[model samples]
Structures are given as structure tokens and as C-alpha cells.
Target: MCGILLHHAGDDDLYHLKEQFLEFPEGSLSSKRCSDGSPIFNSIIPYISARGPNYSSLRVSKKYKTAWYSSVLSLRQPFTCQSIEIEERYVLQFNGELYNHEIVHNDTQYIVGLLKESAPSIPAIIKKLNGEFAYSIYDIQNGTFYFGRDTVGKRSLSYFLDENTGEFYLASVTGSQPNFIDCTAGIIYQYSTRSKKLNSDLSISSPYEIATTMDQQLTKLPNCIDGLFEHLNKAVHRRIVSIHPAHIENSPISILFSGGLDCSVIAALICKQLSNIKKEKKPILELLNVGFENPRTGMLPKDVPDRKLALSSSEILKNLYPDVTIKLVNIDVSYEEYLEYRPKVIDLMFPKQTEMDLSIAISFFFAAKGSGYTISKDGIKEKYQRKGIVLFSGLGADELYGGYHKFANKSPDDLAIELTRQINNIYDRNLNRDDKVIANNGVEVRYPFLDEEVIKFSTMEIPINYKVNKMILRKIASEKLNLATISDEPKRAIQFGAKSAKMTKDGNKHGTDILTS
Candidate 1:
């Protein structure tokens, strides 16, 4: 949603700080300054600014010897700037949405008010937040700095420390800087501004409670499907609403659709929602399917498994929901085009350079770029660039519902442990990498399945029988959603489904292997 950066230092080291750990190139550093005439620690963050190109601001508190920088994409409000001061005391740089109906206009101002009410209890406020976010709040009163992300790391935040100078640096991203690490999800990292030490202590635990036994079997088989269905329906609706009116020509919402069970089920829910809205206000649903051509095998993008399945599934949805309009965007990537963006995308995926990372990021990179084709009136393969800035991804379904192939072999006890492990670690493995790649194109990706309510219902309430193969979701698709034939679509990785894998051509190379380059 936005990019944030902060640096804290003492008087002795404030002016003498070197770029050993937080260096930027010579000319890339923006000469931008704060409200007054003073500069903002001379912030150098050209790498992370792509995520928020709409507006950029830098605020410096020379009294506190701290610099705060933020750039905004402005998806929620046209003029809601960052580094928002709560009652002009607590300085906050927030990136991501806060889905509370009571606070309508700006989430930052609303959150600052919440911070005021709870004064310094950060975790208490974090527990009340039901949406995805990554933020840093500097309590000018107590000189204690705090930063963290939502329980489900839906946004990206990276940080580093200079041991020699005791200067600390945190940003939405600091590209390829050695020892610069991603802040873990579900943690409140803090340090005292008075001390000016570079070390960060685990401030406190988060609100997430993983179920040791993944299944409760609380709801009977008949009602299990209904419970999950209702939970997911509300989740999808929460993300879908609050879209500002049709500012773009076509639509503002899209799904990173592969025609798989996870994505198709979301599409079905959106279609039903779309049907209920009036005809004049209908927001077109754009389903984006990406495929890659294989130069070595002489295979074309159209022949890719993802392309075939997407075309097949489009017809089923069309036949089932005649009233709703669905646009299937066939995004074909030639071998040369994939090579063109590979270097930049890999740069965006920083600190995570694996053959598997490239394969997965490549699919999302093109999908977020949103340059593809849709059938025009004349049935011509017309050139179309997706106007939607918000893309829905079916990311957390596998971790939450045991949709992975590896989950098939594990016993119920082991399955419970593995599911907990994967979901917790998803921040570093998948969410962080995906956020950097997708947000690099100035688009926001939301995962409805990862919503707190949805995750709680699926993992805690649903039975193990329904969790395996994600039978509950399949049933919802078949009976509840009325996409009968789609229930058979098995789980497939985007790399294989989109034909982006095995292109590294490292003979018998595994996905976990680090990139040779």
C-alpha cells in the first residue's frame, strides 16, 4: 500500500553516521526535505519508492535525532499522507489498510486516535486491528520506538542496524544491503530512543493463537461447509467493499486467477456479489491468467496447462452465471519478455534468491504488470492492460486448509504441527517475496482466505477430514457456490500450472536450490 522508512541515532553518531550498513547510491538519493527548511537524515530510498509513487514525504525531528520517510500510492484516500502525527505527538508511518467501519476517512488518523486511547499498550491495539498492515510508531513522549506488522504479514517491512555507530535503520525495503533483514510477522520490535542502541528486543507476543490440534470437529459435516462458506463470504465482502467509485475505465478489481480451486472459488463468490449489485454500478471482474513459453522445448504459451485450464473454466462460469460478466485476460509471455524483467524482479525479491523464487515471482511479476489480452467484440485478440490496482490472490488457502501435496502423507497430529509451522513461516517464505514483487508494480494484493476470521474458522473449527485436499472448500464450490465441475480441479503450483518452472534448465534442479546466478 505504501513505503515507510525510519532512522534513530544519538547526538555523537547522528552527524558522524557512515553508510557502511545503510548506504545508497550517489545520485539516487532524493534531495526532498521535511515541512520546515531542514532535511530528513538525507533519506536515500529509491528502491522502495516504486510501491508508492503517488506521493513522497520526509519528516525530521532534530530534537529527537530521528528521520521518517514515507511514499504513498493513495489507493484508499486521495490525500491521506503518511508520517501522520497522532494529536501531533506520536509520529506514525503506516502502510496498509485498517478495515474498521467506524473510522471512515483515513485509517492512519483513526489508528493514531486508537493509540491515544491505549497510550502505550501497542499489542492491545494490534489485537483490535482486523486488517493487514505494517507500521512504525515513535512515542515522542517516552522516546520509545515501536514497529511491527499484522498477524498475517500482508505487507513488507525490512530493517538493518549499524553496529559501529549505533544507528538503526528501518524501511519498507532497503535493496540488497547486507545484513538487512525482514522484520518477522506477529512481533512488536522496539528499542529506546534515549539509549540509541542498535539492538532490538522482542517487545511482546502477538494476538495469533495457533491450534495444536488443527481440527476440533465441532461443527457436524453438514454444517461445516456452511460455517466456512459464511466466514469466507464475509471475508471476501470486507475486501471487496470500500473500493472508491469507478475512477478507471474498465474496473478496479481483479483476481490473480489460475482457474484453480482456490482462485475459482473466490471468483464464484465475487460473481454472486456482482450479481446482487445494480446493473449501472456493476464492477467487471477481470480474471488474469498468465503463461510462459518454453524456448528449449519449443512450447508456446497458449499450450501451457494454465492457459488450457483457464479457458476451460471460463466457459463453466459463463454458463452457470449468465447474468454476470467475466473477462478472461489471457496473458501470454514470450521467452524474451520473461528474460527482460527477470533481473529487476529478482532484485525486488532480495535476500531470497532461489530458482523456485524466480519461477514463482515471474508469474506474479507479469500478472501484476497486467499487460495481456481479452477477447474484443470482433473476437480479436485485443491488446489490454488491466486497469485494476487491487489484485486478489489465493495465497493462504494451502497453509490454512492443508491444500499442499506434502500434507497428504502426514498423519493428523503431524499435519496439525506442519500446518502451524508453514502458516507462521509464510511471512518470510512467500508473503514477503510476493509483496516485494507485486508491489513493485504499484499494485496492492489482498488475500481474503488469510483474513483473521476465515483462518480461525478453517483451522480451529473445521474437521481434519474437511481440511485434507481442502474438501470443505471444494464442497462449498460444488454445492454452495454451484461450480460443480470445478470441485475436481486439484491443487497446482503457479510455476507448473503457468509453465514457468524448469526454465532454469539446471538439470534435475530442485525448487529449493539457490539460484546459480
Candidate 2:
């Protein structure tokens, strides 16, 4: 939910270092002094805050020109505990919600308390923690830094390290950097289970070839459903806990609610938790739903009918939570407009794949970004300052819950197999779209359906009948939150909802082009 920038001089090259720091705007700077009387310079606050209401905190070291910027976004309010500290020469930044924080805290205190007994290494401390997290710890103590994006890669952390300067910049989104070093194209490495070690990285000519090999190996694993669910749930819970209350109370968390089970579930869970906390005042939970205008003549596919799921979803949500503010945007862009924006959308979403279906999906993302949900006060003048708003989406629900027509013939055993396959496919297909659309605006995204706990419980314990076409989720919604009324209704993809006119070209039909065709 924030951006961090650091500049270091290998020798007495202070002039260039200062110039680099000045390139980002003056108001963006914030300074704090360390225990050793060194000043830490930071400028990410103004850049992030102008995007929306958020709690911004910064730490900078004057001697090192090393800065750490952290912001708790209102979109991720009601977080557990969030803090960044500089201990000696090391800077630690963590976005996480530890299930066993109290226990770990006490253990750390006890260990640190018994200085005469022994001390734990940094790696040992990391091993004692359990949860979903993406953290970067810069050890100025050793002039070396370490960063990891959790074991499951649920939380995102991307960085570009300067080989010439040994300077590293890290952010939650990949495209945040305007300029980056051109690292050679392909790299591959494998982790050894027996040795519990990672192999040295290797470069390859074709990344897809390695990916295919890995996919085949992953498909061979037993209990794929259990493993997939476990990882997914862990991802969701990690993000939920990462929300800081100060940030939530300041700006309010925004949810892209489609009234579908995935987004609806996330909205419900966040609302349920926020209602319990007694903050400065109850933060607003904003729900954004986008609709499209009528299609042109002959645009409708013979098989697909118009369905306003966005409007219906808003109504259902209003019935459930009368307090939330729902913003529905009916996009009226013409086919010509779509063509104009198609390339940018394609570049953002399908940077790797140029398939037509992905392009269609990217069009929906383009419309959503333009819907004003991610717009900041500064406007869209610059991409980085557009907004730091974190968008919560439900991208993997259909794939994991058998909500697609492809799962119609799946038996109980076959259902598990298919679900696992779909879950794996999410990273390349759905995650690609989600990340591209939101990150293009400098906004972060969270997928609650991909939560590890929810995935594990739903897949391992819940009966197959419950998940077959979201049957179990519907029942749970009725019993736990009364969500079943709309569960039986058919699911609609965003592309079909927003661009129905484009669906019938060349005798092709909507939905069929994707699932059955």
C-alpha cells in the first residue's frame, strides 16, 4: 500500500545521489532522524496520500540516503499490526498478519530478554513466524539486502536492483518503476526438498518451455486440491491482516463488488470485522460495480442474453448491508473507443499473451480504470500518483468453485482434479488480468477467494456437491449470510456484461467462445 525509494553512493559521489532524490518532487520528501543522529529521507508519502486517504509513515537515514516509505491504505482497513523499523544498519519492512503474533512476540521478548543464554539469527527469527507475507529487509549492516514474496507467492513484491550501483528499489507492483535495468530474458531454478535449498538461478532461451515442464511436474503431484486450497487460503488471510486501522479509518477500503460469491464474500468478511472495531468513526466501505450500454444492431450473439449482474449485485448488496455506499457506473464507450484503447489494455493485461480472449478481458479492465474508482485528486497526469487504492477482486472463484460450464460433467473425484487445475491456471490467466489493470493505475489488488484458509477449508472439508457450480458456497451464504437467493442465477463474465456487442462477430457466440467453443 506504499512506495519506497533508496539512493546510495558507493564512493563520495553525493552530487549525483542528491540529484536522483530531487527528481521525485519536493513535497514528496519527509525526514526522520535515527538513533545515531543520522537523517533518513523519504518522499513516497505525498505521492501515495494524494491518491486517496491513507495513513502514511516514513523513515529515512541522512547518512545513507536510504529511505523507507510505508502507507496503510484505507481500502485495507482494520489491519492487525503494521510497522517498519530500522535496527542498526538493517531496514525491515513487512506487510503481514501473523496468526501467532502474541506467541511470537512473547518468544522474541523472552529470547531477547535472555541475552546471557543465546541469540537467534535473522533466519531463525523468520522461521519462527507463520503467515502469508511479502517482506523486504535491507541489511545496510552487511551492505546486502534480502527480499522474498512468501513461499506461496500470494503477496507481491517486485524489485529492480542496479548492478552498477548495488541500489535496489522494491514495490508491491511490478510496473511501478518508470525505468528499470534490462535483466536478461530467461532464468530458471529449482528448490531441493531433501536439502531444503534453492538452486542457483539459470538463464534459458524460452521461458515457456521451462514453464510447461514445471506445469507437467506440478500436475503429477498427489492431493493437488488440498495443496492448492491450503496455499490460497493462506494468501487471503495474510492480506486481510495486513490492513492497518489508521489507514482504514482515514480513507475507507474499496471493494469491487459484483454481487458474485467471490467479491461478495470478501465484502461481507471485511464489513463484519470493521463493524466490531471502535475507531475514530465507522469507515465507509465503498463498492464499485460497472455496467455497459446497449449493444449495436446484430451485436448480440444468438445464445447470449442481456443480464445486468452489476445492477442486480448492487441491489442484493444493498439488501444485505444498508450502510455501505455502492457506486455503479454504466460505461457508454463505443466500439470505436474500445479500438482506440485496445493496445494499451493489451499491453497492460496480456504483456505475454496476445490472444483475442485476453484482449476482450483487458478491455473490461480498461473501462473499470476509467470508471473513476482508481482516480486520485491529482488526476491521471502521472501513472505512479494515480492512486494507491487497493482493490479487492474475486478472480479465482469460478475456477476453484466449479462455477464454469466445463465443470458441468465433473464427478466428485473429477471435480477435485478440475478445481486444482483451474486454481493453477489462475496465476497465468486471471491474475495476469487483475494485476495489469489495477497496477497500471498504481493501485494494489487483493483476491480473497485465493485466501489459503478459505481455499483449504472449502476444498478439503467441504463436500464436492457444495462446490460443484458453487452449490456449497450458496448454501453457506444462505445459512451463514443469506447469499443463496442469487446463487442459482448463472454467472456472467465481465467482458460479456460490458461488451455484448462485440461477442457475435463472425458467427461466434458469447460465453461459448470461452467455455464450450
Residue 16's lDDT in candidate 2: 26
Model 2: weakest 10-residue lDDT segment is: 205-214
Task: Report the lDDT tens digits of candidate 1 across residue range 91-179.
Answer: 88888877777867667767777888845586567666768789888888878778887887889888776655556778777655567
Clashing pairs in 1: none
| Top lDDT hit | 1
Q: Which segments of model 2 are wrong by more than 4 Å?
A: 3-85, 93-133, 140-145, 157-252, 271-283, 292-307, 323-341, 356-390, 500-517
Worst 10 residues of 1 by lDDT: 17-26
> Over the stretch 490-513, how does candidate 2's per-residue lDDT look in tens digits?
666665544433432444544324
Model 2 steric clash total: 19
What lDDT does the true structure give each of the candidates?
A: 0.75, 0.46
| Per-model RMSD to reference | 4.5, 10.4
Q: Which structure among the candidates has the greatest TM-score? A: 1
